[model samples]
Target chain A: MDIPTYADVEAAHARIALHIHRTPILTSSFINDLTGAELFFKCENFQKAGAFKARGASNAVFGLDEKMAKVGVATHSSGNHALSLSYAAGKRGIPVTVVMPRTAPEPKKAAVRGYGGHIVECEPSTSSREAVFAEVVAETGAEFVHPYNDPRVIAGQGTCSKEMVEDLGELDAVVAPIGGGGMVSGCCLTLSTIAPKTKIYAAEPKNADDAYRSFKAGRIIADDAPQTVADGLKVPLKELTWHFVSKHVEDIFTATEEEIVAAMRLIWERMKIVMEPSSAVPLAAILKNKELFAGKRVGVIVTGGNVDLGKLPWAQS
Target chain B: MDIPTYADVEAAHARIALHIHRTPILTSSFINDLTGAELFFKCENFQKAGAFKARGASNAVFGLDEKMAKVGVATHSSGNHALSLSYAAGKRGIPVTVVMPRTAPEPKKAAVRGYGGHIVECEPSTSSREAVFAEVVAETGAEFVHPYNDPRVIAGQGTCSKEMVEDLGELDAVVAPIGGGGMVSGCCLTLSTIAPKTKIYAAEPKNADDAYRSFKAGRIIADDAPQTVADGLKVPLKELTWHFVSKHVEDIFTATEEEIVAAMRLIWERMKIVMEPSSAVPLAAILKNKELFAGKRVGVIVTGGNVDLGKLPWAQS
Candidate 1:
């Protein structure tokens, strides 16, 4: 497998430049005071389709050559990736099909359809989803745009940290939530080359700490299905992402579900930005283990902002 | 009583430029498509202290003469103004005394105290608040900075639209929620002189539609007490605001409480930015009266993002 490099990230940035929003980096003095470190938040929550996935999705959809572009792309995700891929394909004016679980939120389904994505629903179980997705890909011959593991998608996510450095200059550390490890690996890929001194940290929920365990064990530790309030971080790390994590990641921190929710609430209250529970893990990790980041300038990649307002974890679950 | 002029706004902008955030304007294609008009949201929710009141509060605090500044400022707001004034006072390193109702949200009181402001509690009644506020002023000799009715405050608020027009070039109409009308008056102060072609519109909650009634009756109509999900807009328009609303405002539109909550939820979910119910009034108004804004490039002032996350208007009210 060809690993995505700085050059691939640069190419991805150029390709997705027009398709995705160059989201702004935001700062909260209150959060800075709370964390004892000045933090620059790369606000991917404000990206097109309301997440950083848009960057990777746009790169994948737009990078396809004329012949492949006609066939379009396909993905199986019940979350931001599905909406992001649909948004990218919609922008490119191409056909994109998303295989989603039948038990997925109705609003998520409507959002995908709203972006002109054709939905193929399967049983809520992972095996059923994988089986149905394979059938769809076999019939359509659409390029499979994996959410995080693919070189192209990882390269696209790298552009986020690239912009962060370009906009905010040097940083002592970069922290992001790790689920499938796409965003975290992207950070590692960029910082390992450009800002070699800047440490890369991956934050995960304690309930789904496969990445943490993998990093400690120096190997890939996949989980069957770990449940957490951070619904986005359930996926295990893939080979491509694990390569970057094992090589470049300084440490992996795990936050409790309550800690994640509390951090999310504090951010919404003080920073006044709406972000999902997954995005709060980094802050939770920092707050829980503050001594490491004290008085340093840190770059925090706020992953996404798609949450069910009617069923906020703190409120309902 | 002096009416704040365009020059006063310019002076206020210069004074508060260093202290306040030149918050970015956010656009949502989803909202744009839904409303049938292009909208530029002047994101004052991102302002220092999390509201446009920061502009005016900073102006008042920083504009103070050194001798007068020693005594600091006082106000009787249990809302964003209280926090904003405290934030400005904290910046200036001066004393800020806020007369808040004892029945106010503990989190709000904590926020006020967090900014190093002295809180003087009064009975949960306007009469008691005014009486206690007067006592605090009399005892401390602190300058009273009225939330919206003052020239300095209005001038400070004007900078929002000033920056909006500077950033977005031209807007066909500008819509803002009106309570005491600091933000709307500010828009009037700036756009009426500079961007004269931009028609000014104010949105009010039907539950507290004194401004709407005042606009229709061509007089200042003060309400004793009114309730709405938009807590910031329950206050009636004062004389300084009425001057602007009567002279420059083209029309005032009202949205029901349910509409206000729905609009707030939509903005939080789709825009992925947290703004208070008061800020949603403009969008609710636009959605309710869509044709007026259809095809027009309009500016919507998102006033604040300070809300009780635990008791969201949609989730509870």
Candidate 2:
């Protein structure tokens, strides 16, 4: 697969600009005082479909030709990507299908359906998901849009950092939680070319430390359903994402489960913003490594805000 | 007591401009669709000290003359007002004392001390609070800043609606949760003169519906020790706040406990913003009275975001 370039990201931004929300960047003096770092939160929690995945999903959905769009787009994600793609497809008046494990959270399934996506239930395994997804694509003759691996998706995700850099000039560092490395890769694709001076860091949960392990081993280290409060970071990095991660990422940091939950609660309490545990990983990394970030202007990408409120990490479930 | 005018609100805004945050105005398309009204949320939950009380507290602390300022300020409350006063006083580098019930939440007391405010514990009753506050004032010779009754504080809070009206030109209605009527009075003070055509609605929890009763009775029907999930709305309307409520407020709406909690959860899940139960009352009222607000542009004040996460209404305690 070809690696997405800055030009491709810029093109994606233009194509998806009208479809996706230009989310605001927020700051909290209380948090700044706590960490001694000037943190700028790119609040993609407020983004369309309540996540940054909306950008990539919208780009792919809208970029299709009328004939292709009529048949529509399909993906296999039970997370934000599924709902985001469905939302984008709905906006474009196209039929979209999401293949999800039968054991996926009911709320997540409901969200996909709410966005007008048809759901195809699969067995709870990687092989099963792939096998079921292939059948869906073949049956429907729909265009397959990979959540993060596709060049078009990476190009779309790149628009987040583009807007961040444009809004907040000359940040010392940019940080994001590394799930499949889509957002970080997008940041790398943009910053490495436009603002190369700004260091890029990816944060991961210690429980699901595949990206961190992968970074140190100088290769992709897949984890088999690693359990963590940050469900978003359980997935491993793909080739396209690894291409940007290995080349442009400064470091990948890990935060313990306790740290991730604490940081998540802190943002909710202080910044008055709702975010998923995955989004809190970057702040956790910053908190864990205070000396490295202190007195620096840092851009922290709040990846998404799609959580089961009833099953909040802190709430006794 | 002199009635606060738009001029007073404008002067208060100017005085507290540097000290308080001009919080953002946010809109949720999902919420707009749910209620069938164009809603503009004045996010005071994002205000300094995590509540709109910060505006009132800052105005009181900063408006003091040099001699009065040397002595500092004091208030008696166990809610957002106490912490906000402390925060405002800390900003001005002035000593402030809070007389709070010994049974007040530990987090609330901690926040007061965190902002460098001295705390004097009192019995959890209005009479006890007044007695302790008087003693504190006598001992320290500090200016007693009332929670809602004071003209300066009302004027300070009026700035919230002033900014809301300014941001969203010509709102059809302005809604706020009535907790001692401070925020609602502030809205009335500003809207009555500047945007008199805009109807003002006050929302209250049916469990603690003193403001609703008072508005209907044409006299203060104060409720003592009212219980509600919205802990912030337990306080009754004082004379000064009642003055604005009686004159300018079009109607006071009450939401059942279930409706308030549901509205609170909806905002958190859909809007991805952290707001306390008190803040959700206005949205609840709008949902209940769809006919009054349907197809109209309404400005809703999100009162505060200082709820105890451990004891969240949805969470099992």
Q: Each candidate's DockQ score against the native complex?
A: 0.89, 0.90
- Expressed as tens digits, the lDDT of each residue in B194-225 for candidate 1 is 99999999999999999999889989887865
* Backbone collision tally, model 2: 0
What is candidate 2's TM-score against the reference?
A: 0.98
Residue range B70-145, candidate 2, lDDT tens digits: 8899999867899999999999899899998887767778889999999999987677888888889889988989
For model 1, residues A91-157, the per-residue Cα lDDT tens digits are 9899999998786767778889999999999876556777999999999999999998899999999
**Candidate 1 clashes between residue pairs 3 or more apart in a chain or in different chains:** none
Error of 2 at B112 (Å): 1.0
Question: CA lDDT of A28 in candidate 1?
Answer: 90
Evaluate residue A184 in candidate 1 and report its C-alpha lDDT on the 0 to 100 scale.
Answer: 92
Cα lDDT, model 1, residue B213: 92
Docking outcome class, model 1: high
Fnat of every candidate, listed in order: 0.97, 0.97
lDDT for B248 (candidate 1): 92
